[model samples]
Target: MQNPKMLIVEDCPAQQLFAGQLLKQLKIQHISYASDGELALELLKQQRADVMLIDLEMPQMNGVELLRSIAKQQLCQAVIITSAKDPLLLNAVATMAEADGLQVLGSLAKPLNKELLSLCLSRRKAEVWPADFERKAPAFDQKLLRKAISEQLFSLCYQPIADMNSGQIIAVEALARWSQPELGMVRPDVFIAAAEQWGLINELTLLLLEQALQQLQQWHDLGVVVQLSFNLSPLSLSDVAFMQQLQHKVQQAGIKPELICFEVTETQDFTQLSAAIEALANLRLAGFGIAIDDYGTGFANAQQLSRIPATRLKLDRSLTDGVSERPQQRLVLENTIQLAHKLGLTLIAEGVEKLADAMVIKRCGINLVQGYLYHKPLTANDCTAVLCNSSEQQAAS
Candidate 1:
């Protein structure tokens, strides 16, 4: 693949020179320079850049305005925010860029290092072309979604969460999958988002929850005592009656509530905070474990954590992917693990694909981990087979 076309938007002449030299040293041929957001916008109108390196403190048009324009006009495919200002300000800008539907490569503190810059550039160059189905998937509507629910087209795949110390499976997170006859397989992200948009989130969530409970019961019958964790929509939390019904169904299925954990996405806004807190509090009271999913990805403040009563905190994959290689990330992960422990919460590091990364998490005192390093999401039968094999191995030993 050809190198990505890049634009550097910085007002400082010396910084621009430094960046230009570095890009040339890296053998990147197509590079453009803009002193401010206005010039950047003008350059973008002439030709689109695949990636943009933005300095937030530019004079004419600040990085914030440039980012807004980029999001409004869909200018660059990816962004790298570079700032020497407050880390909080840098993070706020990056978060804003992401919220505006732009792929932020990451933030870079001023005086960017060659290695980090190369890594960011490499990621831009390595993006895969969209698959045919992804490019052509039909827009889903409420009628079709309702039909999907009624036809039971949704299925569950479980990814094992393991004890980092023992390296034994402790729990499995149930991820939803949807297979439409016409669409082939729709990604859970796609369907789940659509479900939420169409006010079908509650129905879809309960369906997956029921399926997970049934499978957990089956595993129990086979003497495989593994806990199952599944996501709960924020919309579902507003309905007290629905939560009550969920508890009743779990009791009716002869499944212990302790065998299941409901993961609440941190990315969602709790418009009904009190109701959500009460709903989750009730679930925990009834013996269910609650986890704050994608913990570091969202804007949830410390105050929110105190109200939710979460039993576990699942670190987002972004923080876990290369914690060993990145000092800043390692520090953050270490601090997060420390905070979780202080709050009496279990810490599960997700997206631990590399052994080196796993080692880093283990060193940081996180005992639970989930990622492709252990197992990818598996069908119920395959997961059961894994459990049975583990049981056999233990018995033989």
Candidate 2:
């Protein structure tokens, strides 16, 4: 890996000088500067920069437009938005850039100092650059998805959720896995998005739900009482008939609804808010737990939170990755935990990959922790073995 070439797009001469001085001090060799978005566009067209530092407020074409152009032309691999106007506005612009398919490293307040610049530069260095900026997934159609579902090509894996105080595995979350015969192991993110687009999410969700419930039933027969959590598609919540079917299936499985939790991702858009709420309420009334998944990484607002009768809030990985090391992240996590507790919701911290982070989460009063620190998602047999071993340990103790 050679030295990264950086481009600074700032209209203010003073700010440009400041950034240049810092870059030089940091021993950065190749550097470029653009007075405005127009100049930046021209410079980008001529040469490629590994990372770009952009000022939001600019004459001619603004930073937002520059980001659009960068994404359109596949110019820069990463971007950092620096603005003095308003932090909220800058963050919005950064979100827009991300939506446009640009990797937004982060946002920075203007009058940037060496410390902040160094942090941004280090982050940029740590990023793994792809071979191509505009790499697209191979086209997958509805037919392929339906075939995969019908053939039972999808599988479920369980990730344990542990109690912070007892340090015991109390529950497990079911995650869907698919390996396309041709595509090898297709990522859940890729196939899931495709499933939603192709209107096959309900079918996929039901299949996984049935599989998870059946596995839970087997565990129950083995005398291992552990809760199971499974992701629920928002689209399924709008259909009353589907909800009835779900209830019927649970009854047939002879599994208590209380042992199962339906996790609704916060990123889902509830076009029919009333119907969704009614469905969730019905599920809760029927004894199933409702969890707001990926709490801080979505479009869900306070109003939405108040409306949904969620029993648990799962913190997103973005907030948990470095909570113990980063003060800002720790503060955010603490505040979120406090808010959840005030609302009478159990907080489950996700992405606890480090013991230090786990200690911080436990100290924050979050008892339910889930992430790779405990275990990765396991196959049904493996999960059952874990539960059996835990039961044996308890008996021996």
Candidate 3:
């Protein structure tokens, strides 16, 4: 498989050359450069780049204008770079783009140093591996991975969601995981994003869901009843054909309708409220439970909840972050939980990494909790073992 490509669009020839040389020094040889915004657009039209390094002040068609055009095309990923230190201009551009495709990788003043170069380069390769990743872990074999997910090389890890009041295993969130001979244990976020950009997200999601549903069916047969939540991309839901195929696959799996919940990312542009609501309502009518995942983090308002037919609200981790100290956030959480209850929707608190956070969530009356505090997402066998163990412990207590 070919390595991902990077495009450097800079107005200054000297800076462009410097960036190319730096990438070369880092052993990333597939580098392309553009002197101005118009040239960048022309080159991008012919060849798609995985990442684009753009300078703000270009002669014909400045960076902001170019970014707007790119957004319209949805062509290439863009990272803005500018010497402008004014917070107002930076905030305006960031708000306009909002990390959808346009991300501010780094801002370096006139003189760029090795540290800045390293930061930018590291950010570019972030999709390859996660941050703070240790070399002790095996590096991902991109070729093997591309073939594996395509040929059923991935696996499922179920993270137990415990009911705080009862301390009972109520539900489990299905997380996609992979372990190949070449790549010991691959992080799903990294490979999943890569798969989406490579136009394999639909296939990967179907495969993972198939495996997860089969396993959930087995658990159902064993009488261990619990809901299974699966994360889904906005694009996946937007495809009508894909949804039909998914419905067919789910029927074949024979998993109960109410037991499966499809979690849509809150980051997606739900600006067309009527269309989104219509789509979600259709899914709900089809017996697929709908949820607004990463709840408070997205642009969605409480009004959208009434409009959309989502059955559950998964609160964003940010709201629970530092809740012990941030009284304001705690108040917000209290209100959100109450609001969700008033709407007759189940509330799920996600990212419960700390015991204190989990405790806070329980006190806020959020019944379902999922995160590391309960147990990190585990393999299918491990999932069953955890559930069985939780049951045993409850009986003993």
Candidate 4:
């Protein structure tokens, strides 16, 4: 993304000044500001902005509401959602924006730093947006999605999670690969939002689960017994029947529920998703590992940890990526590690890409790790090869 015209929607004067300085340092000159979302919308009514930097904590029409309004009115093309809130909240908001067809550069947690801002800006690809242009909806034929779910057409890619000390693969997280005819490969966030919108998310999740559980059983059959973890959307967990089917599917696969972990986010809406939350608790009680995914991203904290029945805590990549270099990040990571330990939750540090950071995480006592450092998400067959190869090497060592 180029240095296109940008608008900042925020209420805090000091934070606004701070953002201005960072933008200045980056030489982002074509800038404007609105004290609140309402004003921002009004200003954007006349002139369009290439990018909108939003502060989520604004008084009237908070950043999230602003994003909704922008998406509804076609107010902006790209946005950088900023907040003092946790990174999970930012990620959730970003997903929402993307689902609504807004091009999200990424999210930033304030107080903002120039390095991150520059990196996020570099991710922007320069594109000309006509004033009359509207954000494109997530394009997928409902029939196609329904067919894909029913036939189990969607594929799973496995990314290995390892015990850092022994350098042994202990688990693999299943990520969905959705490739549609003609449209080619769709972004996971985009397609997932589509699934929810079309009310096919439950089917989509079950199909993936069936495939993943079967794969895990195959690996176990071959004498490689490692756990399997996969994401579950809040919407997918709303129905008690889906949870029942999930358990039945595991039993039918001849896989022990203990070897399976279901990962869920700190969902967007807490009020309406009480049943889904309860479903997760019940899943935990049923001998399935329930992981509070993305622990340090700002949402899962001391308060949330004590309440949820999570057996595992997977640190978000955002919280661990630069922990070795940044004092503040290290501070947060260290504290989170202690909290999870005191609560007796299994710990896994995600995004352990660097030797320095990996050493830091290892020293911090996070034995389970996942990231590109070990392996990227690969097809089941390819991943099987990688896992077998890893086993051979570990045995030799």
What are the clashing pairs of model 3? Answer: none
Q: Write the per-residue lDDT of candidate 2 for residues 1-397, one digit (tens) a residue.
A: 3467989999999999898898888888899999999999889889989889999889999998999998878888788889897665775676678667777766888788777777667655455544434555635677888999998889998999987676668899998998776667777877887887778888888888889888988898899999898888777789898889888888989999999899987554567888989999999999999999887775654555788999989887667765665566678778888888899998888888878888888898887889888878888899889888877877776
Listed in order, each prediction's TM-score against the native is 0.80, 0.78, 0.62, 0.67
| C-alpha lDDT of all candidate models, in order | 0.83, 0.82, 0.72, 0.82
Clashes of 2: 1
lDDT of model 2, residue 158 = 92
Ranking by TM-score: 1, 2, 4, 3
Best by TM-score: 1
Q: How many backbone clashes are present in model 4?
A: 5
lDDT of 1 by residue, 1-397 (tens): 4577889999999999898888888888899999999999999999989889999998989999999998778677688889999766876687688667677777889898888888777655354323432233446777999999988888999999988766578899999998887778887777887887778888887788889888998888898898889888887798988888888888988888888899987445568888888999999998999998887775543555677889988888767875665576688878888778899998888988879899989988987999999889999999999887776666676
**lDDT, candidate 3, 157-204, per-residue tens:** 888877887789888888888776755676776777677666778888
In terms of lDDT, which candidate is stronger, 3 or 4? Answer: 4
Alpha-carbon runs more than 4 Å astray in model 4? 1-136, 272-274, 298-301, 394-397
| Candidate 4 lDDT (Cα, 0 to 1) | 0.82
TM-score-best of 3 and 4: 4
